[model samples]
Target chain A: DAGVTQSPTHLIKTRGQQVTLRCSPKSGHDTVSWYQQALGQGPQFIFQYYEEEERQRGNFPDRFSGHQFPNYSSELNVNALLLGDSALYLCASSSGGRREGHLNTEAFFGQGTRLTVV
Target chain B: QKEVEQDPGPLSVPEGAIVSLNCTYSNSAFQYFMWYRQYSRKGPELLMYTYSSGNKEDGRFTAQVDKSSKYISLFIRDSQPSDSATYLCAKKRNDYKLSFGAGTTVTVRA
Candidate 1:
């Protein structure tokens, strides 16, 4: 069985441009989350989508947005990207069951997309 | 102060040594704690997960959570060179999001 998969292992973009990263959740997973990991830092939560809606979001600005499809696939879009936005964008998949009330579930991650804004 | 505090150490140790990584959080409501390992330029992989205050051991990896102190720890016994990576400590916060600490990079010299 295939685990979580992401597209465009690496990419380069110009500052102020927009970029889109895609992710396919692990088999049997229902929810997807996005994270940004700067160099030498741990993954920072960006947002999470469940039931085709963004359920929870991190402290990121509105420029960082995401969409989840009915099949549980997800896409993260960054508008007016800044050089500081260059980092590894990670996508994690988890079971949304019981997530509404603080119940936690294990998350599986995909190999991140390395986004570099020049 | 950040919600979670961890020492981002580039710790070097000899192979077969015991390794301990820890993180402390300010939020007492965080009930689920986890440890994730990430290699260079790679996404993090969950290494251990613990609910509430207690210890859970799986092979050489052990996870411990102290809810009273708002602290959590991950211990790796008989560490090998393959274990050289960045170890991150995180907590399930706000139900779906996981607040993470600055990962500690470990190098096990073989």
Candidate 2:
């Protein structure tokens, strides 16, 4: 079975510009969540998508948004990117949504897209 | 204070030695604890997970959780060069989101 997959392994964007990162969840998984890992830091949750709608979100501002398609693929869009936006964008997929019980809800991650804002 | 706090250690150890990593959390609502290992320029891979206040062993990895003390630990036995990676301690509550600590970078020298 194929694991989680992300597109454009590396990307460079300019300040005030916009960028979109893509993710395809693992087979048999229904939920997709996005995370940002800054240099020398662990990943911070961005948001989670389920049933083609955003179900949970973290501390990120409105500039960061995402969409989940019927096929379970997801796209993360960052508008008016800032220099601090440079980080590793990771996509993780799990079996069920937040409404489901937490037990055995292991999330598998993709290699992540490296986003650099110049 | 951060929800989860871990030492960012560039800890170096000889091969076949035991590698210990620890993290502390301030939230008692965090019932699920996990350890993830990430290589350079790669996403984190889950290594071990535990829910209760005790120990769970899997192969060379043993994860220990102390709910009373709000502490969690991961131990790698007979570590190899391939075991060198950044170790992340993560905690989760009823929500699906995870709160992670600053990862600890470990190097196992051959």
TM-score of candidate 2's chain B against its reference? 0.97
lDDT of 2 by residue, A1-118 (tens): 7799999999999999999999999999999999999999999999999999998899999999999999999999999999999999999999757455564378899999999999
Q: What does chain B score (TM) in every candidate?
A: 0.95, 0.97
Q: After best superposition, candidate 2 residue A45: deviation in angstroms?
A: 0.5
DockQ, each predicted model = 0.71, 0.71
Q: Tens digit of lDDT per residue, candidate 2, span B1-110?
A: 99999987889999999999999998787468999999999999998888899999999999999988898999999999999999999998888788999999999999
Note the residue pairs that clash in candidate 2: none
Q: Relative to the true structure, how large is the alpha-carbon lDDT of every model?
A: 0.89, 0.93
Where is model 2 more than 4 Å wrong at Cα?
A: none
Prediction 1 TM-score vs. true:
0.96
Error of 1 at A74 (Å): 0.8
